[model samples]
Target: MNLNLRHAIIQNVASNTKEELEDTIIDAIRSQEEKMLPGLGVLFEVIWQNANEDEKEEMLSNLKDGLQKQ
Candidate 1:
């Protein structure tokens, strides 16, 4: 994402309620058709997979037991 895109995402998500965030995410996914799904999954999976390595061991540990605080 570019600077504007990053700022927009942060502002949008930070200012919204949980329901609104969920709705926005769903809408964004819908707007992208199926193509963006793979990209999104790839993003998550990259973090999930790489975090297992020594470099991210600490983060990986937290992720497993971390509270899903909204």
Candidate 2:
């Protein structure tokens, strides 16, 4: 992460009201994920290493169920 971006996040989140704080945390988590995904083959490799066969299938099933509700 860039130093300026870190500083910006700290400043904004620190100043957040109760309602804004949830959004601030969600945005920070999303930003970190955006920086890691697709190109980060190591992330998939880790997922594969840790997730068992049944766990993967269950995750896929839950994803499909959630999407259908939407």
Question: Best by TM-score, which number?
Answer: 1
Q: Quick one: RMSD of model 2?
A: 9.3
Stretches of candidate 2 off by over 4 Å are: 1-45
Report, for every candidate in turn, its global Cα lDDT versus the true structure.
Answer: 0.60, 0.60
lDDT of 2 by residue, 1-70 (tens): 4557555545545665867865644565578876534323333344567899998898789879999999
Model 1, position 12: C-alpha lDDT score: 45
True lDDT of residue 35, candidate 1: 53
| Candidate 2 C-alpha error for residue 16, in Å | 24
Q: After the best TM-score superposition of candidate 2, give how far the Cα of residue 50 lies from its true spot, in angstroms.
A: 1.6
Predicted structure 1, TM vs. truth: 0.40
